[model samples]
Every structure is written in C-alpha cells, then in structure tokens.
Target: MKNYKFIYVLIGLTFFLSSCEEWLQVEPRQSIDSATALSSQEAITAATNGVYARFRSVALYGRDFLAIPELLADNAFNTGAGNRLVGQFNNQPGSHMGNWGTAYFTINQINLILRALQEVELPVEFRNRIRGEVLFLRALLYHDLARVYAYDPTADIPGVNVGGVPIVTQGTLTVAEVEYPARNTVDEVYTFIYNDLEESLGLMQNFNMNRRPFFVTRGAVAALFSRVALYRGDYARAIEMSEIAMASGVANFPADPVSGWRTQVQPESFFEIVFTTQDNIGANESLRATFMSRVFLNDAVAASHGNVVFTDELAAAFPDEDLRRDLIQRGLAVNSGVFEINKFASKNGVPNLDNVPVIRYSEAITNKAEAHYHLGQFDLALTELNKLRVRAGLEALEGITGPQILDEILLEKRREFAFEGHRFFDLKRLGRDIIKPTGNVEHSDFRILANIPNREIETNPSLVQNRGY
Candidate 1:
C-alpha cells in the first residue's frame, strides 16, 4: 500500500519559532507577500488547494489522525503489533497529545488560508465558492476538535462555561506571543462551527463544479449542516438538512455495504480528499487495514502486525442476516481460536485510494433518522433507517414504537459506522459512557479530554487545557 503524502505545509513548533523572523525577512513564493497571495484568482485557488491538502496529512485526515481517536475511544483496539505509537495511544495522556497535536496542526492551516483569503480578489461567484469551501473546512475541523477535547455540553459541562480548544482564527506569532485565553465555552465553539457552515451553505448554493470526489460541493455543505445540527440538538434542522443532501442524489450506498465501504471514494461520497496510488497515498495502508486479523481473506502483508479487533458487543449488534457482519467483521485464527476485526478496506495493492470521504449522503440519512426519532417522529425515523437496511441486504425493521425505534437507529449507526471514526463522537455527544477497556494500564483517565500538547500550550498561552487532563 502506498502512503499518501500531504501537500499542505504544517505550521508546527518549528514554524511558530521562526514565524517572526520569516515574516520579517522572506518574501512569499507567490505574489509580493502573504497579503498579496490571495489577491488573485490563481493564488486564491492555490490557497484553497493548500487547505484541502491538509486532509491528506498524517496528523489530520492522514493515517494517524482518524486512527488514533477511534483506537483510544474503544470502537477498535490495537493489535499491540506494529508501531510503538499505537501502543502509546492505548495509554493515557499520550492519546490526548496525539489527538490535540494533529487537530491543531490542521486548524492552523485553515486559519492561515482564511486570513489570506480575505485579501484575494475574484468574481463574486468564485469568491463565494472559495470562501464557502474555507468556512466548511473550518467548521469540519473545529467540530472534530471539540469532540476530542471537551466534555458533553448538556451534561458534564455547562453550555456557557465549557472550555474548548482555543479559537485560532489567525496565524500564530511567537512563543512569547502565546497569550492564555480561557477556553471558549463549548456553545461558543459549536456556534462558531454552525455559523461557518451556514455561511458556507449560503455561499455555495449557486456554485457548481465538476463532480470531483476530492472537492467540496453544495451537497457537502448540506451534509455538514446535518452534522452541525445534530451536534447542536436541532433535530428539525438536522432532518431538513439531511433530507436536502439526500435529495441532491449524491449519497448513494452500494448494493453490498461491505464492498461499498472498501471503496472509500465512491460516487455517493459527498466530499472527500482524493489520493492516488502513484502519489504514495496507500489506500491499502490505511488505519482500517491495521486492525484486521490474520484470518480475514482480504488481509494484507502491510497490515500483518494486527492491532485492534472488534468487541463482541459491537459485533453482536448486527443481525444474523446482515451481510455487513461478514463484510466488516472477520475471525482471526489464533492458538486460542479466533478474534474479530473490522474489514472496511480491502487489500487492493494500490497504496493510495482516490478519496477518503469527510462526509457522505448515507450519514445524512442516518442523521435524519436520529433527528426524527428525537423529535418524536418515530415512524419517520424508522422509515429513514430502513432505507439503509434495504441497501444493506437486510429486512426492514418492524413493529417498534418511537423510543424503541430510536434505540434501534442508534445501534444501527454504531454498527454501520463502527471503526470509521464516528463511535467516539457519538458516544460523547449522546452522553453515553464508553465501555471501559479492561486491564489496560491507563484505563480510568481514558475518558478525560486530552490536553493540547506542551508545545502548543507553551507557544499559545491563551489556550486553556481541558479539565482533568
């Protein structure tokens, strides 16, 4: 499997230390200065590409980004085989560091692009579209950050008092420049993300592009709206946005949910970052492959050092008739018999798959179902979930009331999106406690939001650490 190389330049500690000197001494490669870089159509487009490029970085959407969070949260466990880093994540404090580091890395890139975009000149249509993409990306990045770094707003943390990652809307300055800002309340962060998505939806409404799986589209905006609405507990808006995205005809699931899952960059995907085999973006070398047991038919050599397997609880959630059980879960032959692992990615020998979906249409439908159930529209919720069941080669659920149907819908999401990086956030947002990992050395502190890395904390004094970190 080829490892995808990200094109985006990370503004890491090295950059933060040098920013002052570099900003004073060097002229940017494009245009006269950073300010001028966004003044033209070409520069603005490149800036957009730069922001998109971060999706492929190892820390963000790249290998470790999604993998670490899922692994730490209990959706998947590490085989304790391959990398030392994987084991570290299974431990405490370390997991939070990895999560925070990657998220901020991506956030900094978005901030840089947004600052630059403010000065660019382009047609109204072009500007709106570009701005829309920026806003959407910003919202997506912050949403993930919030989930990883804070407690549930409705429960542990007061909506107005909960602290989240610092709002770095502008690029960083210096180490001394690090000013400590108390954590903005969780509601503030969600409001920021929601406002950004709303702006993106409005800006992108008339903008159309070629059907490129790698880029954001109007459909992507709607899909994001559904997600944001869900987080905000706005069931009606969630249902409306999800339905709108689905009605756009963008999020189709394959006849075989298993095969459909293996193809991460399918046509039904709303927005994804494209990867190529030639570019060393190993599609087969993904986080999903790292968890498969040796016995699975499609297992790859690169993933031979298996890490995590599916919990029996997660595996049993699938009905006997659901093909996804066979597609997603497999038994590994060991001296003790067999262990189950998730098989979302097949070993295609191509190092890089063309795309990794950030948002999909099916997610919209699931979001709609969840919202409907919460809104007391039980029949409507089940009806929406059945759409997924029909595609997955399973019988539609029957004879269940509103609350009962909601439980079914939640379980289905857990089964369907298992190991796809949805479980942890779902657990957090729904105010459900994770099934603690037994016998792990660092078990008790697993649920506490990880602290932002020491480097970030040192440089940005204003950034407050999460409680109990």
Candidate 2:
C-alpha cells in the first residue's frame, strides 16, 4: 500500500482530459500540479474521463486482457516472431494477467470520485449519472481483480482456496490514510459487486443519457451483472439480468459478422473503449499489431509482429463456410504458413486503431444459455445457443440433454469469443482443466490463480499471497 506513491500522488491531479464528443476522445496524458481538485462538475467530469482512459492501457483492454487470455488457454499460440507472449503461450509460472497494480490505481481514482460526488453540488440528474458511472466502473475493476487473484466461488479448492483481493472502498491519498487490508472472502467480493450494481441501477433508472456503447449505461450495468452472476453460478440471477440487458437494446448481433468487425463501433458492444486516431498505440503495442500482420484487412505487407496466431484446435472449431472464418487471413510471407486473426484489424480504418468491446450482447445471450442449461432448461438453453450457432453458419442442435447442452454452450462461447479474452476465465470459473497444446493444466493447479504482486505482499503485512506463489 505504501509503495505505490504514484497512484496516491494522482489523487488530486487532472491527469487526463477529454472532450465530451459523441465518442469519448481521450487526450494525451499530461501531469498538472497536485493541488488540482475535483470541486466542481467540470473537474469531476474530467477526472472520470481520466479513469476511463486507464482502460486503454496495455495492462488492461488495449492488449494484455485480449491477448494473454488466449495465450494462457488453448485458443491461441505465440509465433515466436517478436519474442512476445511466448511465456504465456507455454503457461509458464508467473506469466499471467498482471493488472493488479493498474486496476487498483484506477479503483482508487473511482473511489475518490465517488467521495467527491456527495460533496460537490450539482443537479440531481447529473450527480446520479456520474455516481452510477463510477460505481459501475469500480465494480468492474474489483470483479476483474477477484477473478484473477482468487478462485471463483463455484470452483474454490477445499484446503487451497485463498481469499479474494482486498475490498478497498475508501480513497487513499496520503501515507497516514493508507490501510494495509487483507483479502476478503470470494463470496464477499461478489456480493459487494452485486450491491454496487443494484445501487447503480437504482440511480440510473429512467435517467436517459445518450452515451451508448462508449460510456457506461444502465444496459451496460445489466450486461455486466449477467456475466458476474454467471461466473458466480447464480443461474436464476444470470437469466434475469441477461433479459434486462437484452431489453435495453444497447447492442445486438450484427447483420453481417465480417462487416461488423470493420465498423468503428461494435454492433454487439454494450460498453467499448473508443480509441481515436490520436490515441493509436501504434504497431508495437496495439491488438491489431500483436494478432495480425497486416495493418488493414486488405493489406499485403506485414506491419507488426503478428506474434499471436490461432491454435490448431481453435482453427478446426470453425467450419470452412462459416462467416466468422473470414475474420482470419494468411500471415505475411515471412510467417507464411500461419493464419492470423483479423478481428481487431483496423476497425477504425486506421492502423492499430480499434475500439475494444468490454461487454456485449453476445455474452449476455451465451450467459443466459449456460445458466438455463445448468438449471435443467434444455429447450430454453438451445434456443439461446442456436442464435449464435446459426448466426455463425453452424447447424443448430435438434435434440440434446443434460451435460451435452452445457458442452455445446461452452463450445459456442469459445468459438464466438475466441480471441476477445474469455477463454481462460470461462474454463476456470467452471472448474474445468485448461486444455493446452503444451499440457493440460488441471483446475487444481496453483498456477490457475495468478501470484499477488511481490511488492504488495512485502509492504502490506496483512496481504496474503496465493498458494504456490
């Protein structure tokens, strides 16, 4: 807690500024004096925009969240082109999602904004909207932290189930204000997330704002709730929230799968991180560069490493005539024999620039499908599953029962979200072993949970490292 002075120091500075356009266009980072304060709506709005900017970080959605999960699971492989993601591809110990510090940093910012919201005077509508936004963001960060740092409630090992990440709601600004908190129970963390979502929804009801897809909305909150409930194995709640989210109609299945990926805003996105031309992370760090050789879908030359390629198992999952198969193309001549994913290939029509979808309608449908399967509603499950299967040019199942329905749901989820970062967590939450080309990593493997930061353990005596770290 004491070691991360940089995040603490950012408490008062307007570190990032963005204009309120139709899209949230985050400006370049610049540090102002620490005396800057969130005393007014304008200041708080700027601070909130800064928090959203953190999602674009390489540590979060910009790259690692999308790439590392594929590498850690069986869906992707490292081509050894740029010497990147090879360790993750091999399932090496300690080579996992390392966003603990970055997440906490953003969480603290949200905490501060939440605190200030009560004090700073504003119209009830504006204040409620902002509060709803920050609360949703906070829940999202904690959920990500818990999923990575601890076992899911449904899959916790008997003797080896450590606790989830620390639950920090209060803001920390100074050394005297910092608290060395211990891990909370996994159930406690999920309960906290549920509470936050409930309150956020309460605050946002009938409060209409047009920040769809890019900014958090009531629909986005419901969509995320569906995911959280599904991960927690709360089947009934998952179905309820998925229906609420679907009803809001923030996003939906696109008319054309291939054309949808080329659009600036994802038709399926409930919440997406918008990356403007000025914010392009370039060939070195962008998802487009890491996954595909060509900057544009039609380009013939190589642009970046094209380091992460599809695994044979994943490639074989798609049928030859599937529309989704068109999302992959042959790599540059240098890496000729391989095929690369083009899902993130310049959707913005600019090299290395694409919006990252954090939550979407497809997830909600699959979540409902899986939840229904678990609750013994096979017909209802197949109804939701077939939507995606038919959309992807695969034949729908006529008759399936028991575990077979679950198998198809999981398989469809894997195929639909192959490279978009759900592979590893999906298997983990269900207590299933990760089938990798390197070897099968059992559910009980200690590496299933990432190691807490060494510095965090050393500084915060109350902090407990995961077993086998």
Candidate 3:
C-alpha cells in the first residue's frame, strides 16, 4: 500500500511536469492509494488520462504499431532514407517489434487503476465509464501482445509454436510482489481478452460518453471486439459485434475517403490516438515523417526521411482509376525516385503531426466480410465486401464465390489499410506466407513469431524464448 501511494504521487507529479512522457516509463509499482490519491473523482480522472497518454509513444500506435507491421509484411519497402524500420523490412533475426516492455508497463497501470476504482466510491455513472475504458484498454494491450508474441489460435504451427505472452493482471510494486511468470496458451490469452471486453461492454452500457473516436466508447469497444473475434476465429461473434459497432453510430465511412485523409480526425475512426502540438513527435520520428517525404501535405519541397514507401507490387494492385492510388504519389527532391505514401500527410495542419486511427469503420466491414467468407457464406461475403468495393470506386461483384472471394477480400484489406498497418497481421492471422521483394517467408517458419525480449528470458526462469531467438 505504501508503494502504491508513492507511485501514484510520482504519476501525478509526472503529469504536471511532462504532459505524457516520463510517467509511462516509470516502473509500475504495486497498487494505488485508494484512500487518498484515488479517493476523489478529479484524481481518478487524472490517473485515467495518464493511462491514455501512453499511446502516443513511438513504440505504440505513434509509430512502431503503424509502421513495423507494414514493413514486416509485403505492403511496404524501407527506403533506407533513415535509420529506422530497415531491419523490420528485411525480416532480420531478432529485429521484430519491441512493444513488450511498454505494453506490459501500461497493463500494470491499468490493473492498479481497476483495483483502485473498486475501492474508491464515486457516482455509479462515472465509475462505470472509467472502469469500462480501462478494461477495454487492457483487452487491447493483451490482444496486441498475444498476436505479436504468439501465433494465432487458428494458425499455430504444431511443433514450433511456443505460447502466448505472459498474463500479468496485478500491478507489481515491490520485489516481493514480482512474479517470474510463464507464457499462457494462445487460446488462454485470447479467452482472457474476450472476457475483459465482454465485461467492459456490459459496464459501459447506458454510459453515453461523448469523446467519440478520440477516447474509448461503447462503439469503439464493439468495433475492436469485432476485430478480436475475427482474429480468434469466432465468425458469428465477429459478424455480430461488427453490426453492433456500426449500430452504435460513433463512426461512419466518409463519403469521400480521398478527402477524409486530409481531415485532422479521420471520419471513419472508431478509436484514434489523438495528438496535439504539445504531443507532436516531430519530423524525425512521427508517422508522417516516416511515410512521407514532404513535411506537410502540400509542401513544394520534400524535406524529411520518408523512410517507408508502398511496395511496387502494392502500388500496382490499386488500379489507375482507384482514388486510393492517388494517395501514393511520386516523391520530390531527396525522395524523388520512389513513390511515397501520403496517407499520413500532416492532416493536423502541423508538420509531422496526424492523429493515428487505431480502428476504423471500414475495418469492421472488412472483418465481418472476411468472417462471412470463412463460414462459407460466399454470397453473404460478397454482399458485405461490395460495400468497400463500391466505396473505393470499383464495380460491385455479382458472381464470385469460393476462394476467389477470399482473395479479393484479403487484397482489399491490403489496399484499404496499406499504410495504416493491417497487411502483416491480416496475412499472419490467416496463416499466409509473406511475399516480399527481397524474398518469401513461409507460413510455418519460426520467424513468423517475434522473439521474446532476451532480458525477459534471462531474468525469469519460467519464461521461454521464441524458437529462433
């Protein structure tokens, strides 16, 4: 309890000192001082805000989550314009995403907050909303960790697949409380996430929080649940939750996606990581700087690293008339030779600053569409898929069935979420090998799973490293 109180004071002070930086890096401790720091509504709100603030780090949605997946799969090519993402693009050993520490750290904060909420008294409405948001966040973090560190339940290699990431729900404040945990089964980790999200939705009901798209809401939870279900091979649940998400009315497909990318907040976003001038990651590290050469959308000169670009194959997949193709344009100056991605082109009217869309309505459509295909509902799948086809200026298909529909669905996912980071995960979840310009990575290869951090394996006797590393 003493440790928890000290950590809360540290977190509170960090928020005042730095808007969102050091607090997340602080080693998570045991629990919150529910009687003091978390006893008031104001303090709880600040703590909750601090939790959300962690998403802006380059390791999370701010950069790695968006850029690394595309590079690891076939959707992108590292331009070598900067010293980032090249290893990921090359699929080098032990060069995969390093989100483990940050994710686990954030998860500890969430656990502490949940424990505090249960002890602290507040209005029923306020308590439910706060608890629901943190629950949803916990689910999101665990799902991401599982997908990266373990194989999908539907696609695990029989002999080579190890296990899911460690499941740690309690906040660690002292050496006595520290645990040397072993990995859970992939299904076990997913089951934990499913339960968290289900409870989160139940708690959030009738709590009409209005911070749509920017913060967690009933709609975002449902939309994310839909995606999670698809990853877990729960087709009916995926379809059901997607309908619930669209019905929530928090997000909608823009009538014009070409112009939507230019908006500060994506019109199709169910949940987005909001960034302000104060939070700007700047030209060297922002998503905009990594994917685009121009500092701003309409700048005359190309003056940034532009580290990643669409693969020649991906650029060719989009037809000449497809509006999405226009988003990939020829570069200028230092980046002149190759085509650069414009999806992150400074939409916030600030150089190298754009809100990162974590999940969008379009993804819900694709998730349901793919789910329907898996269930052999070919006609229903086509009906769901035509929604995106028509939106992307392609003619709707009337006569397509079997694997062909599946192919089209996957292709559209690549096109729809190219720079936004769905390609590798889409291929991964489906047990598809990654085909890249350099070489092809087979589905059964050990490299399919990211290496567990070496330090974790060294310190924890119970922890087992992934096969290759």
Candidate 4:
C-alpha cells in the first residue's frame, strides 16, 4: 500500500487548526480541496498511477497474494523453513490479518483514486473511460476481498446473508472518521461488483491505447464480469460475458512463441499490470530469479532453503505426454531423486522484466469452460478445455461427463496457471476446503473473509468486524 499516512497526516493537521480557519486560509498549503489538488492532467495521471502502484504492493501482486493464499489454502504449502512470520499465516489470526491488510490497502488506494477522479475535468470520453476503469478496479478488488473473506454464497451457507468487509467509496475523511464501516452482505458486495463491471464494459468499449493490454479495456471488463459471475454461480452470465470478450479478438492468442509467451503484457492479455525490473515492488527478492530463470534451477536462497520444488501430488497429476509439463516445469535431480518447479520462471540469467499478466486469453477460455460445464454443456466444455490443452501441446481429454469434466478442467487450470494467484480462489469457489499441515482445517464459513484492520476499527467505530475475528 502506498502511504496514505501522508494523506492522513494532512487531514489531521487540517483538523488540528480548525479553530484558526482564517489563519489556515492565509497559508497556501491549507486551502486546496482534494478535488482541486488533483484537477490537472498531470495530477489525474498521478492518481491513476496510484492505482497501478498497488499492483506491486506486497498485499496485492506482491508475494503475499501469491504466497499467503496458497499457503493458507490447499493449492500449495509453505515449507515453514524460512520467514516464520509469513509461514504463520496457515492459521486464524495470522491468516485473517495477512489477507485483511493486503485487501484493505488495495481498496483504500482505489477509493482514493475514485475520489480524485470525481474532481478532474478531461475529455468526456476519456473521463468516462477512466471512471469506468476505476469502478472496475474497485469492483475487482472487492470481488477478491469477498472471496477471501466470506464463504461462498452458492455453497456451504446457501443463500446465507453474511456480511463482507466495509465498503469504502470515498477518500474524504479524518483518520477518526475513516477507520471502518459496517460489513456489507456478501450479496450486496457481489451486486456492487457485478454492476460496476457491467457499466465498465459499456463505458470502456471504445477506449484506445498505444499498448494493448496495459490498461483496462472493454475486453478486460467483460472478462472480469465473467469471473465475477462465476464466483456468484451465475454460469449463464459467465458464459455469455466470456464469449463476448473472446469474440472481441482482443484476447486472441498469438503465434509468435517466444515473444508471445515471454511478454508480460501480450495482445491476448485483456488487462495486465506491467512490472519492469526497474520498478519491481514485490517482496520476494528471489521471485524474479526463481520464476524468470530458464532452467528449473533455484537461487541459492531458495534452493538451499528448499522453498521452490513441485509437490509429488502435482507431479503425479500430469500424464507423461502432457507438453505443458515440459513448458512449465523442470525436472531436477537432488539426492538421487527428481523434483520440479514451474517453467514460467524467467529463462537462464535473464532478468525477469516480463510484465505480470493479470488477465489473459487463457482465463477467458477457462472461464468459458467452467461456465459451460455448469450449464450442462459437457462436450462443449471439453472442447474449450482441449483448445488450451492443444495450445500447450497436450492431447485432448476424452469420455468425460459434465461433472467429471469440471474436475478435469480445474486440474488443467492448476497446471496451466500455477503460481499465478488463481489456484486458491479456484479451490475455494469449487467448495474444496483447505486442510492445513498444521492440522487446522478451514471449512466454508464466512470466517474466510478477513476483518477490517484494527487500526481502521479503532478510528471508525462504525466499521463492523468480520465474523470470527
């Protein structure tokens, strides 16, 4: 999270001198409103930058998002060999806090940008696009938040009206006034997310950009809508939105293998946050060296610590002829035994400058497959899943029924998008409970949703604590 502390400090000072309004007005620094402060193109761009800035924050795209969720969930396990503080999140307080901190920080940034966008004057089209993008981003953040914090509304607690985290839409507030708001129902939050993305798809349809996948486009909004709908169990809507997104041709997979596979922001990427070597903000120092290296070799820190090897379960899941195993994993012999690491790592000695693909064509394909399966289009689901399999040089699946096909699709998703932050959410939405190595089991309860930060709670009494906090 970028420092909202500075903003908080400014707000504090403004209140401190409330009695001396006349004197404060005489000072040039004290007169600007939040809107007036960010009215120009430069300022608006800076505000947009704030949104992008969160992508690298430890809470979002940073290692925490990738590591914590997996470790806490069943997708992966932390070795608990190094960094005990991080490894501790396999349980309750630690798990909740880690997720809560990350989500709220991202939400706070979006709220700030949304507030700033309200005051800026730009071309109507551009302004509308930007507003739509902000709404989409905020909705995306909330969607993730809802998934992590609350139980699935469609499953364990069927139709249960559980509350999610506080909904913060504005950035204008004193520290005292801005702590937390009451939890909104999961239904309410999902509704807000769906409505935001629905509007965003319409508003961003014609947004033009020099870089195809660097900014939010109509396709990104549509893809997000599909994802959001899938989470809500609206399979029909999910299939429809994903089909529309794919039909746009914005997410067509390219034929250029090296450039296409290695590039962070591909033409097929609906939306992605670009992370250059110069601006990398993730906390995992060895992440670049681990994932970017061509060979399945780990850095000394990772290799010595034994933190980056494939589990036996995952290795056994792939068939011998699956080409994705060759494309993504590397076999290494250690102590006369073999192990694997996902191949998406940067090639040998190459600095991993590849921008992270936040949303891509493959996701659309998988979304379509899942939706189709849910809609009882078993053969059609298999067709879509096989399209990705063939692209990865694997043989097509055969003789699978609708429900059986869902398992195959999820397994393929685990293999295809491993270590890319999709696994935990996939498992959760599918109603798979996480059984932790610590012997703690997380069943479907709204407890999975994280509580608002204690700092926020102290400042704002209105903020409701998440269940089980």
Highest-scoring model, TM-score: 2
Quote the lDDT for 103 in model 3: 88
- Model 1, range 1-469, lDDT digits (tens) per residue? 0011021122353442233232212224422244444456665565566567666765666555555556656666555655534643454554542555555655665665566566654577777777788888888888877777776554454532347766767654334433345577777888888889888888877653455657777788889889888888988989888877877655666666766555545656888766555334432345544555442345433335445566556666777887777655444443123344444353333533335567866789899999888888888888999988887778898889856886788778777776566766676677665664643332224345666666555555566655555
Error of 1 at 332 (Å): 6.5
- lDDT for 284 (candidate 3): 91
Which RMSD values do the candidates have, in order?
6.4, 3.0, 4.3, 6.3
Candidate 3 segments exceeding 4 Å error: 1-36
* Model with the higher lDDT, candidate 1 or 2: 2
Q: Which consecutive 10 residues in model 1 have the weakest lDDT in total? A: 1-10
Arrange candidates, best TM-score first: 2, 3, 1, 4
**Please, what is the TM-score per model?**
0.82, 0.94, 0.93, 0.81
Spell out the clash pairs found in candidate 3: 29-172, 29-173, 30-173
**Residue 429 in model 2: lDDT:** 91
Best by lDDT: 2
| lDDT for model 1 | 0.63
**Candidate 2 residue pairs in backbone clash:** none
Instruction: Please give the clash total of every predicted structure, in order.
Output: 27, 0, 3, 14
- Score candidate 2 by lDDT: 0.84
Which portions of model 4 miss their true places by more than 4 Å? 1-36, 84-93, 96-109, 115-118, 156-161, 173-179, 208-210, 254-260, 264-267, 282-286, 289-308, 327-354, 435-442, 445-452
Tens-place lDDT per residue, model 2, 97-136, is 9999889878888888888888888888889988998898
Task: Supply the global lDDT for candidate 4.
Answer: 0.62
Give candidate 3's whole-model lDDT: 0.83
Say which prediction, candidate 3 or candidate 4, comes out ahead on lDDT. 3
